[model samples]
Target: MTRRAAIEGKPVGSDAYVALEARYGHFTAMQVRDRRTRGLDLHLERLESANLELFGVALDRAAVLGSIRAVLGDDVRDASVRVYVVESGGRPLVMATAAPPFHLSGRPQSVKPVVYQRYLPHIKQAAGFPQAHLIRQVARDGFDEALLTTEDGVISEGAITNLGGFAGGRLIWPDAPMLRGITMGLLQRMDVPQERRPLKVAALPELDQVFLCNSRGVVPVSRVGDVELRQDGELMARVIGFYDAIAGDPLD
Candidate 1:
């Protein structure tokens, strides 16, 4: 699959990849279809908030959008895009990358809980070494994704997505600190019966269903640790229905 990379809105050469290592920084991921995206405003707001919190300056929304368009170019209209505020030697730089479109597999996920929490959980940190490490460790142990939790087993979120549960025909998101994902935000805006509160690994058995959400989309979880989740197909189908009904916002 073809991929493109750029820094400060200009294409990066093969040799430039090495230099970008030091420029790695915070970012927000999104999927674009026909130059349109779901929750584009929320994605931009995430970048803006992260930029301010990490660099003490507001994100250049126009410049970032232009960079995304520039990197995507005319030929590439549908793809997975990531907008990064690269912290180089001097001032931060805007980097954008376009890759093959991605989507969550409808298959239920199996997650393994780990006693770990990301630093500054609100922002999507560029370096998620701990999360990545735990994911790898759990994968070796036969889990699909790592579920982040406190030392005492308080469920916070998934390594790369927001975690939630459904029971009694209502949804509930963990109250613990985690990135406010764009996809999750969009669902919250719609007419849905949901609430947030501290969730624990032990509570998984109580909920009729579990799910994870990110830019790629939402999917149900089949298992967390040794506990197999109940198959709440109707609830999940309704969620996907609501999500699919959300029209993409035009990038232009």
Candidate 2:
């Protein structure tokens, strides 16, 4: 990911483009290139409250599909979107959604955020609808939180938090098939793991605690499936204290 000073330029593109967000000040723009799927390119921009004069552009459905037709001859019909909100302080924030997967035939399943990130342009298909679906599902499910596991069952990160486990009295995170969240990476760097692997769902019962994390920060799990997590006393206190220490200090 790269960050640069926002530049002043007029929107320049073909007829098959529509505006996504038009605000009044400073904003961050995401222009996706080298797209493998041939449709409208997914374009995103976020205007911070202080920078309200900026214009954030995203294509409307008609314009998006039209762009697809121009490139792939009108056969494409769907796309996905994933969102990440990282603090300037090196913390990573993630948000997943229920955007239905594409090139599937049956009643489509709600798309996960990771799937959206995998196919960046897909977000243009429904704009921000899937993100809304994901946020709503998180509130409804009362899930300790959800994490991304590879198709092979390696645990990575949660839609809103990173994944961690306490096994044999040691703090650990998966080594494969996951996102390697910023916090997870930090812990790993500190030599925190006792064992790391493609953690299996069958192993959940062997841990003392399970936790989730992200830039908005981490929340230790009290329960997982039929298993309940026990407080690790001092360890839990240290974790919370570390998070609280970094709460809003953007320069991390």
Candidate 3:
């Protein structure tokens, strides 16, 4: 919690820090609890695939994990961990950092729809200014978050979380192009009854429940613009129960 960070094996202010300002890179965020993480393999695969796509090279998973463990040390029990791979000097520089754990408010979020879509929606790249801008704009407008949509009014996802809904005893994910969240993928692997289909802003009121999910956790959406969503407690409990059952992979 002392604002510690490192690049490669050097501290942040060293000459190697130039990689942080690189124009192209991809990163993954995860919660490290007791030196272990959930969906650790999925996180590694995401980094490997993105590195290959951007740098034409496969990321070294062991090296990446080593960097993470090096920075985390043995003292930090719970922390927010981020691993970044930046293309610099025609090569990829992998850096990992760990900080104090992030805790969400746990209160239901109120979101407002915004007309926007991410470029290369599947990759979790560092170019997030547009999405960050939308989130700030909506926050100023008295909303907790922004629900991104395409020009045709089809919901793509939230500014930071994957959007999904409960309808007729199934989990309905927006079929539009967006980043495939690790948490979302885990839920699918757990065999949660789910379907992917295009969701429109105008149909918000028709859904039985609305929720947002990311690496942190799943949260209910109490309101989408002016439409109030029914917070089905039983459904949310089941979803959380599924997430809770997943075991974390050891960092060692």
Best by lDDT: 1
Candidate 2 residue-wise lDDT, 182-238, digit = tens: 444444434354667667554655777666654334556665544555656566566
Which should have the higher lDDT, number 1 or number 2? 1
Error of 1 at 194 (Å): 1.5
Candidate 3 — worst ten consecutive residues by lDDT sum?
Answer: 13-22
- Sort order, TM-score high to low: 1, 3, 2
- After TM-score superposition, what is the CA distance of residue 112 in candidate 2 from its true location, in Å? 13
- Runs off by more than 4 Å, candidate 3: 9-22
| Least well predicted 10-residue stretch by lDDT in candidate 2 | 2-11
RMSD (Å) per prediction? 1.6, 16.3, 1.9
* Model 2 regions more than 4 Å off: 1-132, 150-154, 191-195, 245-252
Q: 2 or 3, which is superior by lDDT?
A: 3
Clashes of 2: 16
Residue 25 local lDDT, model 1 = 67
Per-residue error (Å), model 1, residue 90:
2.1
What number of clashing residue pairs does each candidate have, in the order they appear?
Answer: 0, 16, 0
Instruction: Give the least accurate 10-residue stretch of model 1, judged by summed lDDT.
Output: 14-23
Report the alpha-carbon TM-score of model 1 versus the true structure: 0.94
Candidate 1, 132-190: lDDT as tens digits? 78889999999888999999899988888888888787789999888889998988975
